[model samples]
Target: MTVTDTHTHLYSDAFDDDRKVMIERAIAANVTRFFIPAIDSSYTKAMLQLEADFPNHVHLMTGLHPTSVKENYMEELRHVEELLSKRKFVAIGEIGIDLYWDKNTLEIQQEAFSHQIRLAKQYRLPIVNHCREAFDEIFVVLETEKSDDLFGIFHCFTGDIEQAKRAISFNMKLGIGGVVTFKNGGIDKFLNQIDLEHVVLETDSPYLAPVPYRGKRNESAYIIKVLEKLSELYGLSQEVIAAITTENSKAIFKV
Candidate 1:
């Protein structure tokens, strides 16, 4: 059973001590595909090095993360555009308005989000969005940009049935991760109501670790916990969940 972790920060310093061993552990557990998201230009080198080292396993996305939107955001967006012009990427992603960290930057964040969405449309690539405490704001931008070309994964989706359906209307697949395993993670209550085709699996590692590793650092191999939870929720076997989610991922990433 091949598993795809649609979102993970393999280049994160969290894995610095045992990057190779940690990735190998995930591979041994059948989590072979790792889609890496960009935060800003600073991590670009590290992300590229990760791809160079794990050429077959790693796929990369290019964009300016919402939280990283600051005074030099225009410069950062330029970097994103330059990268897009130079090489191929799976998507323009992990981009959206994040009001949680700093509400003051909402305007800039929305501007960045809209700009990146246009970039994704121009490149004919999918988008991998990162929305946090700004569903209304994110939806507003998505509403303005809605088109046959506007399609991607709502990375780390945690919303109500109405929000989930709204995201689907924009052609986004819900990126289900460790949150589903949490007892209070409300999405689990209504997730099965959504078709499996509209969902994809992720770890968002080295963060949002599943149940057993809740308070601890997360790794790709721990995605199994997420898979098991999804199997239980969807009334399917782990293998089948893995197959369907991986196929859903392929449909989005085109990889």
Candidate 2:
């Protein structure tokens, strides 16, 4: 079976000491696809270098993450436009409102998020969203920008059934990761209600590790743990889980 890791940061500083080993471990576990999310211009070089180093396995995205938005967000948005002009990216991502960290720049965060969503539409690419304690804010923008032309994944989704339905209404898929395995993750309560085809697997490496690895650094190989949990929740085999989610990812990313 070919498992797809829809969101991972292979170039994260957390993996600097053993990036190769982590990737090899993932590959050995049959996790064949790696989709990398972009943070900002600061991580552009590293993301590109990662793709260059593993062209077949790694896919790159370009965008300014929500938390990365600040006073001079226009400058960063300009940088995003510049990168899009130079080459194609799988998606415009890891972009959304992040109120968990700071609510002071909420206005600027909304502006940047909307701008990037338009950019994604303009480029005809899907998006990978990063929302934390700001689903309402993020949904407001998504509601205004609702169109067949705009759609993508809500990365690391940890919302309720209502939010999941709302996201799907906007043509977005819910990205499931290690949280589904958490005792109080909340997602598991309603996940079974949603079909497996609407879900995608992710690790969000260096963060949100599954049960056994909770509080520890996460790697792509650990995606299997998530797959296992999903299987138990849905009463499906690992191969079926991987196949359906992989197809779900391809439906969104077109990769």
| TM agreement with the true structure for every prediction | 0.99, 0.99
Q: Residue 4 in candidate 1 has what lDDT? A: 96
Work out candidate 1's RMSD over C-alphas: 0.5
Give stretches of model 1 more than 4 Å off.
Answer: none
lDDT for every model?
0.96, 0.93
The TM-score between candidate 1 and the true structure equals 0.99
Could you tell me the C-alpha RMSD of candidate 2 in Å? 0.7
Q: Tens digit of lDDT per residue, candidate 1, span 85-198?
A: 899999998899898899999999999999999999999999999999999999999999999999999999999999999999999999999999999999999999999999
Q: Over all chains combined, what TM-score does candidate 2 have? A: 0.99
Where is model 2 poorest over a 10-residue stretch in terms of lDDT? 190-199
Residues 1-255 of candidate 2 have per-residue lDDT tens digits of: 999999999999999999988899999999989999988888988998899888999998989998899877899999999999998889999899999999999999989989999999999999899989999999999999999999899999999999999988888889999999999999999899998767899999989999899999999999999999999999999999999999999998889
| CA error at residue 154 for candidate 2, angstroms | 0.6
Leading candidate by TM-score: 1
